[model samples]
Target: MAVALSTLVEEANRYLNCAAISDYCPNGLQVEGRPQVLRIVSGVTASQALLDAAVEVNADLILVHHGYFWKGEDPCITGMKQRRLKTLLKHDISLLAYHLPLDLHPDVGNNVQLAKQLDITVEGPLDPSNAKVVGLVGSLAEPVTARDFSRRVQEALGREPLLIEGSAMIRRVGWCTGGGQGYIDQAVLAGVDLYLSGEASEQTFHSARENDISFIAAGHHATERFGVQALGDYLARRFALEHLFIDCPNPI
Candidate 1:
C-alpha cells in the first residue's frame, strides 16, 4: 500500500502536534513530488549530500529536520539552493521537514529522547509558557556525580561530552539537543542542578561558572539523531513502508 503525500503530512502533523504554532518554514511538504510514497528516507538535514543519497535509493519522499525555504534565507533560487530543489523536482521526490516541531514533540522529540537515553524521568518542559521550548527538565533515577553523569552521556551518544561541573551532584538535570545553550538560563531558573545541551558557546561557560550550574555539551548531531530515527521507525511501522534513517556524522 502506498501513502499519499498529503496523508503523510497530516499524519506527521498530528503525530508531532505542532500544527498550532508559527514556524520559520512550512512544516510539511515544503517541496511536493510524487503523490504516492512507498520508500521514505530520513535524515537530520536536507543537505545536497542527503538529497543525493535519497536519489540513489530512489526514495519516494525525503523527511528531514532541516528543510529548505527557511525564514531569513535568500528567497531567490540561485546557487546551492537551486541545485537542491532542481534535484528533488527532477526526481519527483517529495520533501518533508519538521524543525521545532520535531524538537518539542513529547515522545519522539530530541530533548525527550535524549532524556530517555540518559535515564532522566522527564518532569516537564523547561519553559512551560513557550510552546517552542526545546529544553526539558527531569530527575535522574539515582543521583550520580557530575563526572559520572557526563561519562554516561558520552557513552550513550558515542561522543565525549564537554563537562563544566559545579559544586553539586546531579539529581535534577535539564537538556536540549542541538545548539540549545541559550536555554541555560531557563534551566537555572527551573532550579536544575545540571544543564546539558548539544553545543557550547563562549557565554555558556560564563553562565555555568557564574550561576553555579553544571553544564555538559554533547555533540549536536549525536544528540539529535535519536528523535528522528525514532520517528522514522514509528512511521515505518505505522504505514508499513520501507523507511531507513541515513546518518551523516557531524563533529560539532
Candidate 2:
C-alpha cells in the first residue's frame, strides 16, 4: 500500500505536533521526493551509510531524528552536505526528520522509550519550569547500587556507558538522551539519585561529584535509536507502508 508523500508528511507533522515545538532544524519534510510513499527507512541520523542502505532497499522515504539545515550550519550545500542531499535527490527518496519533536513526544519520545528500555517508571519532567528540558525523572522498581544501574544501562544500550558513581544507591533517577548531559544540574535539582544522558561534558563530572549524584554517559547514537524506530513503526502501522529500521552504528 502507498500513501501520498504529502499525506504522509502532513499526518506525521500533525501526529508529532511539530508546529508546537521549536527545533534547530525543520521538523517535517526536509527533502522532497516521489509523490507516493510505500517503504520507509528510519534511523537516528541521516548519514551517508544510512542513505546508501535506504537506496539499496529502494525505500521511498527516509525518516530520521537528525536532519540537515541546522540553525548555524553553512547555508551553502557543499562537501558532505552536498553528497547527502545528492543521495536523496538522485534516488528520489523523500527525507523526513524530527529533532526536538521526537525527543519530546510523549508516546514515542526518546526519553519515555529509554525509560521503558531501562525499566524505569516515569514520574514527571526533570525540570517542570523548562519545557525544553525533555529529560525525565523516574524510578526503578527498587533501589540498586550505582554500579548495578550502570550495568543495566550497558546491557540495554549494548554499549558500556561512562559511570560516575555516587555515594548512594540509585532509586529516583533522571535521564535525557542525545547530548543531554548538560541537564545534570536540573536532574540534581529534582533530587534524583542518578542521572543519565548521551554525552558527558567536562563539567558533568564536577556536577555529579559535588552534588553526589550518579552519572552515566551512554553513547548518543545508542541512546537515541529507539524513538525513530518507534515512530517508523507507528507510521508504518498507520499507513500500511513497509518500514525498516537501519542502524548505521556510531561509537559516539
Candidate 3:
C-alpha cells in the first residue's frame, strides 16, 4: 500500500527516461517530502490550487507534468513561487515533475495519448530530421473536413479550439500537446493536411494558409491532461499505491 519516496522517484525517472531528455525544468523530484508515500496526487501543473487540492486529500506526493524551477526563471523564491513552495514544505509532500520526458515517452507521452484520444493512428515523428521535436505525425482512418476535425478536437478536449480553416480535408495530421505551434512548419514539412497544437502563435495562421494546411489551437491545459493521468495510473498499478488526478483547469 505504501512505497518509499526515493523508490517511487527512481522508478518514475527510469520509466519516463527522464535523464535522456533535456528539458526547461528538472525532470523528477523537484521537492523532497516524507520518506514513505501512500497516496499520490497528479495534475497538469503544480499550481497553488492543485497543491491545495493535494493537501486537502492528504496526499503524500504530488506528481505533475509542469513543476517549479524552470530554466531562466528568477532564482529568488518570492511571491507566488514562495507561496507554492511554502505549501509543499508545510505539508511535506514530495513534488515529482516531468516536462519534455512526459511529452516524448512512447506509451504515455502527451502526443501519443492525444492521438489515441482523437482516434489518430500515429505514423512517426513530426520531423524525421529532428529528434528534439516532441510532436508526432498521424492519420485519421478517413479524410474529414477541417471543421469536422475541429469539432472532434472540441469534443475530446472539452474546449472550443481556435481554428484556422484551410480548404483541405484532414487525413494526415500532425500534433504536439503544449505550446507547440512553433512546430507547425515541421508538421507542414511532414506533409500533414492538418496540424494541431495547444497554443497558436501569430505566424501560425499564415503558415497554415500559405501551406494549405488546416490548423487548430486547442487550449494548452486541455491538450496536456492525458499524459499525467496515464503516468499516474501507471505508477499506481506498478507500485500498488492509491493515485488521484486533480484537474485545476486552465483556459489557456
List the global CA lDDT of all models.
0.89, 0.95, 0.94
Model 3 Cα shift for residue 112 (angstroms): 0.5
- Could you say which candidate leads in lDDT? 2
Q: List, residue by residue over 189-251, the lDDT tens digit for candidate 1.
A: 999999999999999999999999999999788888888888887887888889989987788
Q: What is candidate 3's lDDT per residue for 1-252, written digit by digit as tens?
A: 899999999999999998888888889999999999999999999999999999999999999999999889899989999999999999999999999999999999999999999999999999888899999999899899999999999999999999999887898999999999999999888889999999988899899999989999998999999999999999999999999999998999
Worst 10 residues of 3 by lDDT: 18-27
In candidate 2, stretches whose alpha carbon ends up further than 4 angstroms from where it belongs are none
lDDT tens string, model 2, 1-252?
Answer: 899999999999999999999888889999999999999999999999999999999999999999888999889989999999999999999999999999998899998999999999999999999998999999889999999999999999998999999999998999999999999999989999999999999999999999999999998999999999999999999999999999998999
Give TM per candidate. 0.95, 0.99, 0.99
Distance from true location, Cα of 239 in model 2, Å: 0.7
- Off-target runs (Cα >4 Å) in candidate 1 are none
Model 1 lowest lDDT segment of ten? 17-26
Q: How many pairs collide in each candidate, listed in order?
A: 0, 0, 0
Clash list (residue pairs), candidate 1: none
Ranking by lDDT: 2, 3, 1
